[model samples]
Target: MGKCSIKEAYVRIENGQVYVCNMNITPYEKGNIFNKDPLRPKRLLLHKSEINKLAAQTAQQGYTVVPLQVYLNGSLIKMEIGLARGKKLYDKRQDIAKKDQRREAEKEFKVRNLY
Candidate 1:
């Protein structure tokens, strides 16, 4: 299902097709030395339907999908990707506003509950 412990990801466009690739993870341990030449390709397992959907998106002129996250799930590693169409400036602003509102509401609720 997975190749190794994935720490990061990168998206690349090759031949007009969008592909997500795994970035090497270097542990920040004292004895460990970071290797810059450790780039390797990792295979992603997805449902046939999902692959078809991604294929369709890639075929489009201005649409591309990319990996958003890669993390450990129990002892297994899982990757999460986005079927993204580039967001407009307003969309980003709206997302920030919504997050701020949610955070403020949570803060108010927590403050009111204090004895």
Candidate 2:
């Protein structure tokens, strides 16, 4: 059983404090169900300045801050935060096509087995 990083983090503004809610850890993504806690609120690590910036962005309507990945970087757990607006349908389709093309190119690459 493997451990799960954060699946998702939704930022919320409550009483002038930046709060992250709805942290879900799924076994499907984590590889197995070991000490699974689905509805736990994990504390996010961010500097005061970064938190303030995220808080400000979230305060504005239609702006959001989301955690995309959580990984152990050099003995410390770090979360990659993104301040992003919602993407449209066309944008998502373009992203999918780009990914498919990249995968296809990689698949066509030849590698010599020198064993």
Q: lDDT winner among the candidates? A: 2
User: Going through the candidates in order, what is the number of backbone clashes in each?
Assistant: 0, 0
Overall lDDT per candidate, in order of appearance: 0.65, 0.68
lDDT of 1 by residue, 27-51 (tens): 3445445534345655566666767
Question: Any idea what lDDT model 2 has?
Answer: 0.68
| Candidate 1 ranges beyond 4 A from true positions | 1-19, 27-37, 86-115
Itemize residue pairs with steric clashes in candidate 1: none
Error of 2 at 23 (Å): 2.7
Please list all clashing residue pairs in model 2, or write none if there are none.
none
Number of the top TM-score candidate: 2
The local lDDT score (0 to 100) that residue 35 gets in candidate 2 is 55
RMSD of every candidate to native, in Å, equals 6.4, 7.2
